[model samples]
Target: MGSHIGGDELAVSNPTRAAQEISQTIFSLDLGGISTVILNGYDAIKECLYHQSEVFADRPSLPLFQKMTKMGGLLNCKYGSGWIEHRKLALNSFRYFGNGEKMFQRISEECMFFCDAIDMHKGKPFNPKHLVTNAVSNVTNLIIFGQRFTYDDRDFQHMIEIFSENVELAASAWAFLYNAFPWLEYLPFGKHQRLFRNATKVYDFLLQIIERFTQGRVQYSPRHYIDAYLDEMEQIANDKAASFSRENLIFSVGELIIAGTETTTNTLRWAMLYLALYPSIQEKVHREIDSVLNGRAPTMEDKQRMPYVEAVLHEVLRFCNIVPLGIFRATSQDAVVRGYTIPRGTMVITNLYSVHFDEKYWREPAVFCPERFLDNNGNFVRRDAFVPFSVGRRHCLGEQLARMEMFLFFTTLFQRFHLQFPQGSVPSLRSKLGMTLQPLPYSICAIRRQR
Candidate 1:
């Protein structure tokens, strides 16, 4: 029964109904030959991921991830002292580059370039996918490589396309089958093969960049993440257990590039789709941006004054629920949750989709209402169940940076243009399920807003 219910169908199908049918927040299943546990609802998620985070902190050795990552990078590395040191370094690096006035300036500059690219469309219908993705990925590129790429850089563009393709392939039915039966990867033809090929291409691109940086880099005068990581590798060269190495550095940078790019890019795309679908919400958001910024560049400081914009951004995160299952985790040791004993190494799937639409925590869970996030006085109110970044120790590493990018890019676009569907054509709101939930391909007319 577990094998029948827990295949590719589980990846694309709604797990909330299954949870309802079973009438349990926490349940176990045999996925292929692997023991797996699913966590549903806010309460169950909070108990396992937050209160008992350590026991459920490690990442599972899924076959696909094991093959691609070799259990070396920060995201999929086994939980231990090595992971601890790498995470600390990563957190500190993020703080250095992702916070304060400098980071705000960086994102605001990209917003200008983004709006300029859209202006090239001249208010005609065009899919925002490429421009939006380039803009978002540039921000991540700046953090990791100390520079940004022009929108026309074919190499950079190709790398982004590869990243996007791998994401969809990783979440496809083939990836699930590959994970269940590792031997299938040996076959010559399958989506799994494409997945491997894409990984190799991305790794090659990153390696070239790393090699260039290594040669030109100054010792201890780190220009970007790569330089800093190199310095760490040199210092820890003699430490046998240290996770810092050339190979790990490559994988770590790749993980950062993907994580920092994909989620925020899709969220921005979803926001535009939603705006086109519901013009009234877009109008309100535009009014908020205009009133708050008043023809000025938006910074993190302006976010507090724009309550409606805040609510809309939060709503987009909740409504879209990108990264719905989040990064899969494993038990560090035997654990008990709500009287259920889960053995050590059991795979844990956090049903973030269920939490976002959980009827108990939200009012009108199925509706697209940003107003739900607003108080009676029209101020934005943060919800307890709003875990778009997931929860606990292994939650999104780039959450702060992502929030900054979303707010600045979102407000900038709306402040300068009005998004609307092409005449007589309304795009479907239905999402394509990949590793992240993305809007179906849609084109919108971005008419410039005259003050």
Candidate 2:
């Protein structure tokens, strides 16, 4: 089944169809194995998933984290009593540290820097992947370490490049093989080992950053994520069950940076590509921006006035949820759902693509249409299926910032220039699934938009 995709078995090239057929067993049908259970349908998937007191919210065990991190990775932990403590502490810490007026100012300042950097590209043919990731990463960096890096910074670029590769590898067949079989991970394939090694290197860097921040080596007031964690650690110094330890602190930063930076940047990349491939839609967006923005950097307030642009952004997310099926979850214990008994440890997944593109909820699910999100008054209206940031207890920690980041960066860029794909090349708008759904590597020319 690992290599079965795109083969003759399905005889179809559609990802949604393939996903539906392949994943019809969690509540409706069952394949014969104990370890393998496929979640079927959107409602059954959501019902069985959201009810799990998060007991099944544990990520699947993988060799890289298990062996490399010694099984203490925050992202992989089960959502039991202990995990609940950690999750709550982390969420509280995020709220305390981020989204404040000062942080919003920081985000705004960095975003202007981002605009200037793109201004250098000058609407030319270029691969904006690293730049886009770097800009978004800088937001998390400021939140985590209270620092910024130049685009050419060697170490920073290495980390982003390696992390991006890891994201891609996570969706590759190789990772699937490694996760399913523990022993094969040790084999000398440079691909598998290198990715894990780079991850450890990243962890080590994160740990060092944590140590430096704790040691007061970076100087100035520590107002970012790590600073908040250190502060919590100090206050909870006497609490026996405190989850604000050094390890959890590091993991929180890791999850925040990785999850926060990767998703927003990838979705922006996809949006740029789609806009480039389709000019009339791009023109409409530009027209909306012209009326709403009036030649100024888009303020957060401008979002309400700019309906078409906002709807287009929503459509971009709807069509290509970076983590298409979202993070895989498991069952808390044996429970009956949709007339079927699911055992504990069953891998439960939410097919976001299913929800986003479900014909029941959407019209012309295959085509790119932002108007679905527009109301009669032309305000951006959200649908129940708009779970790009996810829903329920474990929604994205950086949802607020991610939304702000996407709207700000996307509208600013589009208002300034028209994105165009390379002449004579029509790139596929479909994403390749991984831990995140990412667009294939492609370049686009950004022709400056006429005033």
Best by TM-score: 1
Clashes found in each candidate (C-alpha, N, C closer than 3 A): 0, 4
Clashing pairs in 1: none
TM-score of each: 0.96, 0.89
Q: On a 0 to 100 scale, what is the lDDT of residue 364 in model 1?
A: 69
Query: Per-residue lDDT for 318-364 in model 2, tens only?
Result: 88877776776666677676566766766666767767767667887
Question: Runs in model 2 with CA error above 4 Å?
Answer: 1-8, 19-34, 51-56, 62-64, 68-73, 215-222, 236-241
Q: Which stretches of candidate 1 lie over 4 Å from their true place?
A: 1-24
Q: Tell me the TM-score of model 2.
A: 0.89
